[model samples]
Target chain A: EAGVAQSPRYKIIEKRQSVAFWCNPISGHATLYWYQQILGQGPKLLIQFQNNGVVDDSQLPKDRFSAERLKGVDSTLKIQPAKLEDSAVYLCASSSNTQGANVLTFGAGSRLTVL
Target chain B: QKEVEQDPGPLSVPEGAIVSLNCTYSNSAFQYFMWYRQYSRKGPELLMYTYSSGNKEDGRFTAQVDKSSKYISLFIRDSQPSDSATYLCASTLYSGAGSYQLTFGKGTKLSVIP
Candidate 1:
């Protein structure tokens, strides 16, 4: 079985510039998630998707961040007019079911450097 | 206060020694506990998971949770260099919709000297 896959393993963007990261989860997994991990901090849940519908995004910075898991498959997380503090690693993960129970398989994160 | 707390230790130990890591959380609602290992430049991988309380063991690793104290622990016996990485403690409630979203602690970095 293949693991979760992500693109642009590392990205560097200027402050206020738009950036997007993509994620392809493990096959047959029904849950997808996006998280942000600032340096010296743990990953924070940014958004979660059950199939194609969003289940939670309470911590997402709605003012600048958005994500979608269209068709219940590959997902994308975007940040527009990004801020300097947005410099962090964006992680993507998946699980076998919506009731993940803390069992997750993660992809190599997209490290975004917002200068 | 942060809902979860953990020491971001750059913990160094010799191979074959037992290693212990821990986390304390404030949310009694968090009933599921997990430990993840992250290698450099790689994403976190689930190492162990426990239910509300008690202990679970897998091979050389053991995970313990104490709901009363809101404390959790992970112990690795006869550790190996491959175990050198960041160990993160995470927990969450049983809410239906957002069950996949986990609350994480800053992972503790462990180095096992050969």
Candidate 2:
């Protein structure tokens, strides 16, 4: 089966600019997640979607970031007016929502650089 | 204190050696534990998963979880060069509702030299 897919393997943008990343999760997977992995740290959850509805997004920066997972198949995470601190790898992962089973399959994240 | 604590080791070892990675958590509510391997420039992949306190073995990897001590470990037997990567320890949230949130450690970098 195909793994989770992310576009723009790498991205570079200036501060205050806007950037968007897309993710296509594995087929049959109902849970999608967006995470930010800063250098020297583990990925932190930005948003989570169970099918088309959001399950959690408490960590998301609502003022500068927004995400959507319409139709419950694909997802997009956008960061507007990117800041220097936003330079990090954005990862998308998916799981089968088997309840008690949350082993995530990750994509080859999109690396972002804010200059 | 952080929910999970891990030593960030750029640990280098020769091939065929045993590597032990560990993490400590303060939340006794964490019932599900996991270890993920992440390559440079890539996302993390689950290497092991275990519930509560016990040991689970798969191939050359062993995952041990001790809820009493709030400690978890991943042991790689006969490590290979390809196994060199960053290992992250994560604990699931208390809610059983589809097992939503996860708190991860800073990750330990391991290098296996051939």
Candidate 3:
């Protein structure tokens, strides 16, 4: 089975600019997640989607970040007016909604650089 | 205090040695524990998963969860150069309806030198 797919593996933009990353989860997977990994830190949850509806996004910086999963398949995470702190790797992951399962399959991730 | 704490070590060990990694958590509600390995510039992949507390071993890797002390450990025996990567410890409540949040430690970097 194909793993989760993310596009624009590397992106460079000036601070205060806008950037968007895309993710295509594995087939039959119902849970999709967006995580940010700053250098020397673990991936932090930015948003989570179960099917087409959001399950959690409390850690998401709403004022500058927005995400959507349309039709419950594909997802997009956008950061507007990016900050220097936004220079990090954006990872997309998916997992089957099997009862009591939490294993997540991840994409290669999109690396972002804010200059 | 953070929900989870891990030592961010660029720990170096000779090949064929034993490696021990650990993380401590503050939430007793986390009943599921996991260890993920991530290479440079790559996303993390699950290496082990444990339900509640106990020891689960897979080949050269062992995962131990002690809910009583809120501490978890991952041990790699006869470590190889291939084992060089960052190991992250994560814990969460059972992934079910209305509760899917995963709390992760900062991650420990391990290198097995040949």
Per-prediction fnat: 0.76, 0.61, 0.55
DockQ for candidate 3, please give it. 0.62
Please give each candidate's TM-score: 0.94, 0.95, 0.97
Residues B15-80, candidate 3: write the lDDT tens digits: 999999999999888878999999998989999899868899999999999989999999999999
Per-model B-chain TM-score: 0.94, 0.95, 0.95
**C-alpha lDDT of residue A110 in model 3:** 100
Ranking by lDDT: 3, 2, 1
lDDT tens readout by residue for model 2, A1-115: 9999999899999999999999999999988899999999988999888889888888999999999998999999999989999999999999886757477889999999999
List ranges where model 2 is wrong by over 4 Å: B94-99
Q: In candidate 2, which residue pairs get closer than 3 Å at backbone N, Cα or C atoms, i.e. clash?
A: none
Residues B17-111 of candidate 2 have per-residue lDDT tens digits of 99999999998777689999998877898887999688999999999988888889999999999999999999887333464677889999999
DockQ of each: 0.70, 0.65, 0.62
Q: What is the lDDT of candidate 3?
A: 0.92
lDDT of 1 by residue, A39-85 (tens): 87889989988889888889999999999998899999999999999
Error of 2 at B91 (Å): 1.5
List candidate 3 stretches off by more than 4 Å: B94-99
Better candidate number, 2 or 3, judged by TM-score: 3
Docking quality category of candidate 2 according to DockQ thresholds? medium
| Best of the candidates, DockQ | 1
